[model samples]
Each structure stands twice: as C-alpha cells, then as structure tokens.
Target: MLKVQEIRELIKLVDQSNLDEFVYEFDDCKIKMKKHKTETVAVSVPQISTQAVDLAPQATAVEAAAVKQEVEEVKEAPAPEVKESSTTENLHKITSPMVGTFYEASSPDAEPYVKVGSKVSTDSIVCIVEAMKLFNEIEAEVKGEIVEILVKNGQLVEYGQPLFLVKPE
Candidate 1:
C-alpha cells in the first residue's frame, strides 16, 4: 500500500523538476511514479514491492489458490491460436507513451489484458501504466499481432520504454 503523502511528494517532484519519472526503493518496498505527456494532469503510482504487506496471508493465499485452479483450467482447455514469430527487424515496437509502472492486468487477481501472439488493433488496450493512483490504459497504435512483450509484469517503465514488439498484419 502507498501513502498519500508519498503520492503528493511524487506529483510535486514531477511538477517541480524536469524529470518525467521517479522511482524509490525503501527496504522491502519499491515505488515507481510517472506522468504522461498526453493528458494535462495524469499521475500514476504503481507499487511493485509491498514492504508493509501483512503477514496474515488469508486473502492472498486464497487468491493464489484460485489462480492455480485457473492455470489448471487453461491446461485442460484447447490451445489458443498459433501466431508467427515476428522478426525484430520487422517488428513495430510498441512503446510506453508515458513514464509509469507497467501492469499486465488491472489488478493482481485479474488476467492480463494482452499477451504475446495476441491479435490487437490500433485501439486495443495492451496494458496499464499506473502513476500516482491513476491507471492509464495504454493502447496499441498500430494494428497487428503481438509478437513479443518487452517488459515484465509489474515492472517499472520509463518514458518511451518499449512495451511490446508487434508484427503488423
């Protein structure tokens, strides 16, 4: 969990400094803050490492169990569509339009919005980048099939960071 003061400080930093993104690591916690250039006032704060996480894992344990079940279900289900691997040279890189924390899903308990080999359009939501409490949906600018995901889930991403490599259809 993030503190309100921290978010305020991050937003203040962005407004006061020339830097577009900020990252902080304290003990067991890591916080990433970023602001996109598109929107007038957009702030995202994605907390990757939870230092103050409660040791009582009842809620978390249950969620993990559910996820395991879902994994089993996927294994039992038919395979998804096969997609051709896009060459690096031919790939049109999908980059982060803003500097924030990159998230594969809306929340920890949810499935990722997009994956490698997934078909996507220009308006497809590839992922979400969170800065200051605001979650900004990142869209694919070009129509194509996702070939490779450059960043890992919950990873701290900088401005103009390469998020995915798409093969244009």
Candidate 2:
C-alpha cells in the first residue's frame, strides 16, 4: 500500500507535468489515469485489496470491523514528511471526526463531493464515512480550495486522520 504522502506526491507531480496519462503499479494494487477534458487532472481510483473481495455480505458488524482493522494494520504506515511551500503553512487540514470507512462519495457510482482545485464552503459535505450501517456526511469545517485529498474512496480511516488539505482564500 502506498503511504498518504506518496499518493499526494504523485498527484502533485501529475498536475505539474505536461503528461496527459500516468499509471502506477504496486505488488497489490494498480492506479490508472488520464486527463479529463473538462479539467486539468482526473483521478480514476480502483483499490483491489484481497480482503475486500473475501468479505461476505452477510458478515456481521464485528466481522466487517475486524476486516477493516486488519487492512488498516497492513496499510497504514508512517508517511514521509512532504516539503510544503511557505503558503502550505497557511493551509488548514480537514480531519476525520470519527473512526469509520472513509468514502469520497455517497455511493460507488456517484461523483466525489470535492476534487483538487474545487472551491467549497464551510457547509459543504466533503465526504462520507459509514459506521455501524449509518452513513455520516462529513462537512468542510473551513471554506477554501481543495488542494489535496489525502484519503481515497472506500478507504478505512481512523479518527483525526487528515482527509483533505485546503488553501483558505
């Protein structure tokens, strides 16, 4: 699994470069990309963790949590410190309010709540986190431009995890 910083760096590189397509492969995962004609960058994410496929729909809440915990244990590693610009010092972090499955949209078929360079207000729902069969809509605590999305869709996130970095206008 790639660390959060690794993903962020990849996004930054994609935005800065002239290339229109990028692909990254790992032993357990693969990320493919292409430029969105309407936008400068587009991200198509697919995470194929063997654990997710093995999870049975009839699995109990405890079982689902157990699987999530196991994946978290294997995936969450200390990310390297990114060298932020002086302006980055002014960027505020939007953190998870609870420990649950972090989702970038309401459902698998829906567009993400926010994207890089998307302008948003404090009341906007930035993401969804499902816990105990309840879907929680996470709001943006600050109004700003979304500079980065730290976590991916369907990712299992912990409490106080950095979900997004915003550059306040």
Best by TM-score: 2
**Best-fitting candidate, measured by lDDT?**
2
Query: Candidate 1 residues 1-169, lDDT tens each?
Result: 3344344435444544666666766555454545444443644332221122332333466644554454344224332222335348788888877656789998899999998889999999999998766899999999999988987887656567688888899
Q: Could you tell me which residue pairs clash in candidate 2?
A: none
As a TM-score, model 2 comes out at 0.53
Residue-wise C-alpha lDDT for candidate 2, range 44-163, written one tens digit per residue: 222223233333345567755664565454434443234457876889888877666788888889999999999989999999988656899998888889998888788756667788
lDDT of 2 at 73: 47
TM, every model: 0.51, 0.53
In model 1, the Cα lDDT at residue 37 comes to: 48
Candidate 2 has its poorest 10 consecutive residues by lDDT at: 44-53
Q: How high is the lDDT of residue 64 in model 1?
A: 42
* Inter-residue clash pairs, candidate 1: 43-131, 44-130, 44-131, 44-132, 45-131, 45-132
